[model samples]
Target chain A: MVFTTTKFELLTNKVAASFGLPDARIVTVDHPLGGTDRATIERWADAAVDTVVALLTSG
Target chain B: MADKGELLEIVDASPEAVMDYFDDRGWGDGLPLVPPTVERVEAMLAACGGADPDEVLSVLPPRFGECTRRMVAINAVLAGCRPDVMPVLVTAARALGHPELNLRGVNATTHPVAPLLIVHGDIATSAGYNSGLGAFGPGNRANATTGRAVRFLLLHVAGARPGPGDASTQGQPAKYSYCVAENTAASPWESYPRSVGVDAPSAITLHCGENPHNFHDMEADHPGPILEKAASVMATLGVNNAPIGQGEYFVGLGPEHAATIASHNWTRRDVQSYLYERARLPAGLYRKQFGSLAWFPWMHEVPDDHLMPATGHPDHFKIFVVGGAGKHSCVVPSWGMTKSVTLAVAP
Candidate 1:
């Protein structure tokens, strides 16, 4: 969760490393949520993570 | 009396004194701000994984000052975001600094638009973001804090302190913080990320916007005429982005409305094409009010009567479906000058 004004990739990589996850483990996706609402976005995020975790575990 | 705890003192002092302190220090929002303190700032920093407080995220234009992470923490703390939510704020700050996001030009524009935060993926859920009813209002921590922190950072860090350089005729409510999550459960079409070709997992997108104009069509069960209505509103003149040429537009379709479109086997692009084709305001509507509306210099030879002159490239209309299962839709016009840009949210 470290935020760098510069070097975003490196920062995300650091997080993956801390989690004992490979760089490939880090997934990056564009947000589908509209900017005008919050609950909808949160739900989508929750679903996205669930889907990702399920895929990871199934593999 | 050398330094009798400024935080405690400000809390105990008069509102006038507090405003004076912030104004004197150029920390107020041209209005006023709740005084920020060490305890509050630390709490806010904790939201974003407790990163070092001194990291610089942006050097905003107009004032062109370094928006250090610590300063951002202070503002976020004051804005009342949970510490973990700070990463979202940081990602947003990072996005604003992107050359394409063009916060400098946005801040300077006379348009009544503000940066709108569109959150996606796991972070939105982890932070308890609101994507349901009243999702845009103050009760939601993720929405309130993430958006407000950006506003506070913009003012305190980047220095868009109004009356100095940010001269909007009527600044929007979003100036305080305008962030929301999408309701994917309700959307039948591919989520925004999928439409844009990203498959990773989560991200944050941005749209420079004025207020949203809702389309209430509970009477219509079908998606076509409802979409037509939405598009007509989108193409109307004197609205935020319509006065100018194309850039990007946001269509926030609620669940029932989204289902209608999805049931029709319409992909998000299909819906976008429908809207784009219909976004034609009369040529007469533009010439009188927006004198600057004309063909690009390269098209000087083309006749002026061309319908729907190209305001930007074809990718101008950006669309996504979210919100509860309600009979409603919304169209948020672009700021008419800036384009919507998406930045991946850092974990």
Candidate 2:
């Protein structure tokens, strides 16, 4: 699974496609990872974890 | 002999027209370029001493274009490099091609870093590369053109064009043309290439680095105080080395500073060890700067108050004496994952 920022979506999608990974395996957060407070980071982490769990369990 | 590649004719145009043609096609680096006429390209190839023009040097990434000797010569001619500098450009390209250097990641990342070409040995003097006053600045043909050729290769051959591939948010000026030779004659220790086990007349080491940050210490006559000055710069939280935790860092010591440090009975190893010990950030400070997400699992579990070394090991701190007639030194921060690669220049 890959986790990247929305700004890097174009690049991340290109890489994922190159590696032949399905869309379900890729997760994107917001762009500009800088200036983000700890609370925001934790929230993103929680959301990412849930996404990974859902992706794995749905299979 | 020029390899059989596609050719174009300007149809009796003026020099400005030729420049316009290249600029229109996005072939020039936003600077005036010497037109790569067939004669000039063949002259560069001839300087390669009968090496096969078709010899594939490396496959550059993002676009994954295969760079051949003939292609390099064409870029060299376009960059206005003299024939003698071709070998240095070739060696530098080969060093970047090394997997350990991770050129692909370097080109793709948003990090403000570029490959710095550091030349060591007698060829530096023979090629008239500036290792003295204003060495890192302009006015020297060898230093300027050799670096420009590599930049063009990255753009045209490697496909690291800005925006699409090179995602540098605010790229430093060094990305324009960053190349310097070691002032070996004035150094208090062995030349950098020799220290790294290459005994060639000239060798090029490609380092993925940022612009040099000046570390001034004119008042410090003692090595201890001089090193303290360096440690302060190295441990700055703004640099990638601080939060990332493991990367090779370079300290370019001026001649006077190197002599002062040598007077204190310190070998290069001693200096590296000293810097490694002092160039550290407290875990608390790291946490304050980066918060809890900054902690990498591989980092040794240390308390918040514990001091963490900037690099993984002492040897990761590469110290070389360069510059001319000053107490001013510089700390070149790395791109964080790439290791420097040194290769001998082909005769």
Candidate 3:
């Protein structure tokens, strides 16, 4: 599974396809990942945790 | 010779209409483009001296588009490049695909880094490249269009469009066109390629770095004060090289500055040594700011207040003379993970 931000959602999709991973599992979060506060990042991580776990467990 | 991609058919419209069509499709670089007719592309490809037009030279990133001789020539025509400049662009495309360059990360990172092409040897003159006063700036056709052709490959083939594929925070002017030729005759040292042990009659070095940051000192008769100032510029907290120990810095010394430094009987290695020893900051400062410090083992073992050099070694300071008669010099900071590649232009 791949973790990315919305700003890179399209690029992730394109790059994944190019590498022959057309069905690569990707979990996308909101934009502006680097410049945010710790609490905000933690919140984003918490929100995306469920999707990451599901991708890890299922086909 | 076969074309690489599918042929597009458009109406025989006015020049303005054609420009509009290209702009709508994201082909225009906010500047007017020369209509790349099939004849012009064929003429540009003919300059390659029998290289197969359909041969895939490089597989560019983001889109993984196959870059063939035909596509490069087509983009060259669109950039208004003369047939003589084809060899430089072809060599640069190969350099872009080199693993050392890390072009994928260069395009993906939010840092405003662009590839700066330095043309060398007979081709620099035969192709009419500007290496004299204001070389990095505009005013020369061969330099301008050849540089633009490289960018067009990123745009058309690699699909590194500004918003999506490039992802730069605040894209710089160098992203449009960044190229210059070494003023080898004006310099005190040998040609840059030869200095680096690439003994080709003609070559090109593609370094992915921020735009040139000019530093000028008019009254310095000796190399000490002038070089010390350059070290101070490198030690700044804002530059990406501070935390990344392996980062490379290309210091372009103006001819007058090079002459002054040479008067001290300083070789290129001497300048590199001086800059490496001086371009430093307190290790504590780096630790306080960034969460992770990507340094060498010795750098990591140093005490908090110990002064650490900007990069790992003196060899990281790649020195060469550029520009015309002036006391001005410039430093180009790398994007940290990428390495510059120098290759001979194909005959």
User: TM-score winner among the candidates?
Assistant: 3
Ranking under DockQ, best-scoring first?
Answer: 3, 2, 1
Evaluate residue B316 in candidate 3 and report its C-alpha lDDT on the 0 to 100 scale. 90
Off by over 4 Å in 1: A1-59, B1-35, B47-52, B294-306, B309-314
lDDT of 1 by residue, B42-105 (tens): 6766665656556677667656656656666677766766777767777777778888777877
How well does candidate 1 match the true structure in TM-score terms? 0.75
At residue B92, what lDDT does model 3 achieve? Answer: 91
Best by DockQ: 3
Q: Judge candidate 1 against the unseen true structure and give its global Cα lDDT, from 0 to 1.
A: 0.68
Task: Give the range where candidate 2 chain B is weakest over 10 consecutive residues by summed lDDT.
Answer: B291-300
TM-score of each: 0.75, 0.88, 0.96
Error of 2 at A22 (Å): 14
lDDT of 3 by residue, B1-347 (tens): 43366677769567788789899888858787888888888999899999888887788897777888888998998898999999999999899999989989998888999999999998999999998899998899999999999999999988899766888889999999999999888878888898888998899999999989888899999999989988887888887777898999999899999999999899888999999999999999999988777788889999988988989999899888789977899999999989999999993
Label model 2 with its docking quality class: incorrect
lDDT of 2 by residue, B1-347 (tens): 32345799887567788889988887768888888898999999998899888787887776666777888988999899999888888787677688999988898888898998988887798888988887888999999998889898888887677765677888778887888899889888988888888888889888999899898888887899999989899888888767775587888999999999999889999999999899888877787777533334655477888887777688888888778887899989898878898888983
Tens digits of per-residue lDDT for model 2, A1-59: 77788887776665454345536477788766778887988888887887778777875
